[model samples]
Structure formats: structure tokens, C-alpha cells
Target chain A: MKSLLTQPIFSFFVTIGLFYFFKIIYTKYPFALLNPVMLSVITLILYLKSFQIPYEEYFEGAKVISFFLGPAVVALAVPLHEQMVEIKKRKSPLLISVGVASIIGVLAAAGIAHALGASSEVVASIAPKSVTAPIAMGIAQKINGIPSLTTAIVIATGILGAVLGPGFLRLCGIKDPLAFGFAMGSASHGIGTARALEEGELQGSVAGLAMALNGVATATVTPFLIKLFF
Target chain B: MIESLFFLFCFLILGEFISTLLTLPIPGSVIGMVLLTVALEFNIVKAETVKPSSKILLNNLSLLFIPPGVGLMVYFNIINEYFLPIVISYFVSTFAVLYISGIIVQRLDRS
Candidate 1:
């Protein structure tokens, strides 16, 4: 059985099969907490745990899936590149908005966490929660917070921002494409960018730009914010 | 499809190896991104080679987050302890950033 697991095609189809099963639940239920990724992962983990399947055994296939993240992010550059003309025209505004949003995100999250009686570590971990996972982890680690916890917070933040951003933007009276894109990117990262893409190409491109800029901005700002606070 | 999968696996293994060598504080995926960027810049790899696999992976990027999110189940105590403040602060701040930044950018564009 273990030897049979080494077949790449078998592993590939099995993972996809698992993903399809959860994707259905995700579509049918649409619960915030029951996010497709979260659901699929839980299902996979539980299946492995119950069957005494080691992570190594599962990773044989899962790693193939994970490997594609790099090129995926790079491909984002295509949509973004296509929007270069608009991006150049609005470059300054985009930069300023992303910068301000990053600072506000760090301050707002940290301040509220502190206000609600969270430990210093918890407060700090959530400070960079809006950025992508890798950068968020680095920011968290830099400020002496737990990287694992920071990853969790960042994912939750991304999902919430993605799910709620459009309705919230309408509520806030933001209808401009560039404005919508920047706000979603700054607030949510990739998940929100996905939502933005579905809305329109221009919005998606701007959101992609925002996601990259947010990564850069939060990385630069969070350390400074940490210094200012401590 | 098979060839695309092979190239992707190689890219990931290379990324993992590079990540292990580097002392950067970021995740391997981020490092992998950087590595991919450099490879593209130098023409060590063409965008076409990675495009197909990357497309499929990124389209379903949200799926990757599931395991870690479920890991939150283990941290229920920590979450419960900080639930109110975290939720309130995170959402309020998120919305504020969206609203304020949108206004600021639009204003700047006009000015």
C-alpha cells in the first residue's frame, strides 16, 4: 500500500478528488469558517490521522501541489503588466494609498488587540496580519511573536477581507475601480485579489499591484511600527 | 500536463533547497517567488515553462490555506481568550484601512 502511494498520478488524482469533495461543501454551505482551503485541509488531515497515514506519505503528492505557488504569483505579474499604463498614470496615488493602509492595518489591529486584553505577543502577531503569509511571519518573528500564530491570523484576515470587501466597499461609497482594487489589495492580499479579479480585469490588476505593494509596505512599516511601540 | 507537473516539482525542490540555504525570515514560498523572479530576469527559465502549472495552482490558492486554518482548532483556547478584542480590532482596522485609504487615493488622484 505504501509502495503504491509512490505513483504520482494516483497521488495527484486522489488530492484532486479530495479537493472536489470539499469544493462542493464550500459551494453549498459558504460558511466563512468553512472556507474551501480550510475545509479541504481539515478533511485531508483527518483522513490521514484516522488511517495512520504519515505526513510524509501524504506530502508525496501534496508537495507537487504546493510547488506551483511560485509560478502562480509570478503569473500575477501578467495581469498586472497588462495594466502598466494605468498603473504608471496612477503610480503615486497607488503608492500612497498602500502605504497608509499598511500603517493603519498594523496600528488598528495591534491597538484593538491590546485594548481587548490580549497579551503583547498576541497583539504583535496580529499587527502584520493583513500582509501575505511569508511577510507576515517574518514581521511577527521580528517582533518576537509566534510565526505559526501569525500565519493563522494572516489567513483569517485574508479570508475575511475577501469575503466582505465588496459589500463593505459599497457601504463605504467606494465605486472607483482603482480605489476598489487598492483597498482590497491592501486589506486582504491574495484572497481579496481573487475577489477583485472576478469583479473585473482592471480591478484585478490593480488589486494584484496592491497585493505586491502591500507586501512591500507592510514589511517596511511593521518593523518601524514595532520599534515605535516598543 | 505531465511535463508541466515535472517542471513544477523541480522548481519546488529547487525552491526548498534554496530556502534551506538562506537565512531569510520569510516562508519558502516567498523565497520561491523571489527565486522564480530571478530565474525569469536572467532567462534561466522562461515564463512559458512555469505558466501552466502556476495558473492552476494560483487559481486554487485558497485551497492551500485549509490545513493551517484548521490548525486553529488546536488554538481554540488562545482564540477564545482573545476573541473579542482580536475580532473587533482586526475587522475595524481592516475596514478603516479600506475606507480611509480609498478616500486618500481618490483625493490624491484628483489633486
Candidate 2:
């Protein structure tokens, strides 16, 4: 039974099954708090704990899905390419927006964490929370933060950004899809980009662009920002 | 589908190779994104070849995030210790980033 459960294929199915099940719930309710990723993670954690299954065993199986993240991220270029005309039209403002937002995101996270009495490691981890997980984790490691902790923080930030970003934009009376996508992608990374895609293709494309640009900018600037602020 | 997937993998691998060679801080996949975009722009790779695969991947992108997210379990103790600060910081800062960036872009677009 343990061997069966530990098989990579078995892990894949369980993850897919659990994710789809929660995904349906999310679709029906369509609430930010009912985020499919958060729900699925909690359920899987509970499932593993109840079965006395070690996380390592689960991870060994689930890593297959994680492996696709690299390719999936690469796929973002497709949408970005599709929306290139729109992006190129306003290149300067968009670039400035991404660069400024990237800096602000890092500083805000680190500043808030520090003000709240977080340890230096925690502050460092939080600094890259707006970037995608792999790059954020890489940045965290460079700054001596626990990469796993940064991964968790990045995920939480993504979900929260996905959930609140659209609503916040609506409230702020920002209706342009491009701006909407840019904000969501820069703040939330891939998950937020996923949400932006659901709104429309143009939004998705811009979100993908934002996510990629912010990832690059954050990776380039985070180490320096950490030194300056922390 | 297979062909598109093949192109994606090829570009991604090439991106990774280049990133490693350059020792760039950016992830290889992101570099792959740039490469794929360039390929698409110049017609080096047809859009149709990668459209289907890229759509499928991007649509379900959130699902790929779960494995790493589940790693949060490992930090339960540290999180528990710093629960308030961590939670508060995440909540406040996330909203702040969203609000500030969104407004900034919107304002810039208006001008």
C-alpha cells in the first residue's frame, strides 16, 4: 500500500484529483478565499497527515507536476508575444510601471516584516514575495533566507494577490485590461496571471508580460534592495 | 499537441542553457519566455505550433503552484511562532503592493 501510494503516478493522480475537486468548488463559488491552490494544499496536507504519509514520499510523487513549472513558465511567452503590439505601444510607461512596482513591492514587504519584528531571515524571505516562486526562492537563498519559507510566503502572496487584486482594481476604478493585468501579474506572479487570463485574452497576455518582467526585475534588484534597506 | 510541446521544451532547455552559461540571476524558464517571444515575433517558430500547448499550460498554471505551496507544512513551527507578524505583514504588504501598483499604472495610462 505504501509503495503504491508513493509511486510517482499515484501522486500525480491524487494531486490532479484533489485540485480539480477544489477547482470545481472555486468555480461555483468564485470567491477569492476559496482559492483552489490554497484549498488543495490544505486538503493534501490533511490527507497526508491522516494517512501518516511522510511529506518526502508525497513530494517524490508530486515533484513531477512541479517539474512542469519550468515549461509552463516558458509557455507564458506565447501570450506575451500575442500582445506585443499593445505592449510596444506604451513601452516606456509599462517599463516604468514594472520597474517601480518591483522596487516598491520588495521594499514594502521587507519594511512591513521588519516593522512587525520579523527576523532578518523572515524579512529577506518576504522581500521577494511578489516574484514567482523559483526566482523568489533563488533570491531568498542569495540573501540567506530559508528558501522553503520564501516559497510558502510567495505562494500565500500569490493567492492573496489573485483573490484581492481584481476587486481592488475595480474599486480603484482602473478598468483598462492592460493595467489590470500588469498590476495583478506584478503583485501576484503566475497565480494572479491565471486569474487575469480568465477575464480576457488581452488581460492574460498583459498579465503574463507583467509576471515575466516583474520576475526578471525582482531577481535583478532584490539583492541590492535587501542590502540598502535591511 | 505533441509538436507544440516539443517546441516549448526545446526553447525552455535552450533558455536554461543560455542562463547557466551567462550565470544570470533570472530563471531559465523566464529566459525561455523571452526566447520564445523572439522566436514568435520573427516567425522562427510559428504561433500555431506552440499556441495549443501554451494555452493549456497557462490556463492551468495555478495547479503547478501546489507542490511548492505544500512545502509550507515544513515551516509550521516557525510560522506558528511568528504567526501574527507574518500574517499581518503578508496581508498589509500584499494589499499595499496591489493598490499602489494598480493605481500607478492606471494613472500613468490616463496621462
Highest lDDT scorer: 2
In terms of DockQ, the best-performing candidate is 2
Off by over 4 Å in 2: A1-4
TM-score to native of every candidate shown? 0.76, 0.94
lDDT of 2 by residue, A80-145 (tens): 888889888878777888888888888888888898899998898888898888789889999988
Query: Candidate 1's residue-wise lDDT over B3-109, tens digit each?
Result: 55566566556666776787554445544555555566566766677667666665676655443444454555666777888789878988887787777777788
Leading candidate by TM-score: 2
Task: Point out the worst 10-residue segment of candidate 2 chain B by lDDT.
Answer: B97-106
Ten-residue segment with the worst summed lDDT in candidate 2 chain A?
A: A90-99
Per-prediction interface RMSD in Å: 3.5, 1.4
Candidate 1 local Cα displacement, residue A184, angstroms: 1.7
